[model samples]
Target: MRDRRGQGAEPDAARPTERAPSVRSEGAPAPPERAEAVLPEGVEAPPAADLAALFLLLANSALFHLGEGPDAMGEAAPVDFAQAQFSIDLLRLLREKTEGHRSPEERRLLDGIL
Candidate 1:
């Protein structure tokens, strides 16, 4: 009698007839479809550290202006200013590092911003 696989196929003696381990047996669940995060035209996604720097800059600026006067808040004014400056500096550094490599579209975007 022929095996289940039919002609030329021999039953593997090492494998159980009922449930042989399959190399292709239903692999890990198919990867879920994901939508790419669409950034605005001409802009590339910033590195994590650069984004974090931007966040810190904005957050510090908000904190600084929320109060009436610099002296109104304790030591937060200067500290916030320093934090914001540092973040801005970091952002500038990142831009400088990538300056020459930007595409024409990127240059236009940066020009618009500046």
Candidate 2:
């Protein structure tokens, strides 16, 4: 039978299948690339550019200052409404700046966080 391109099936079967190389061999676990690439001790990892992660971080910070969550250090600090307000304002600014650019999921997440 001829394919849509008018090529015979036998001719196509004789051609080698082209595919990208696999990163790992069969039955082998994936290499720990991220783990092996370590930085000097006490050095912080590079800042992430993920909008969702940033949003969650800001939300958590705000909640922590507002006494609704624990600090990054896991300590319960006194409530600071002013600081919380500032964080929330920052989130609002992000929403404004990212208007018409965010995916539906991102918009929904931001709205829910707000």
Among these predictions, the greatest lDDT belongs to: 2
Worst 10 residues of 2 by lDDT: 1-10
Residue range 14-83, candidate 2, lDDT tens digits: 8788896767678887766655448899988877668988889899889888898665688777899999
What tens-digit string does per-residue lDDT give for candidate 1 at 19-102?
A: 644554476666587666889999998655543345445444545554423755454344455555654565466568768876
Q: Which runs in model 1 stand beyond 4 Å of their true positions?
A: 1-79, 110-114
Q: Would you estimate the TM-scores of all the predictions?
A: 0.29, 0.55
Clash count, predicted structure 1 = 0
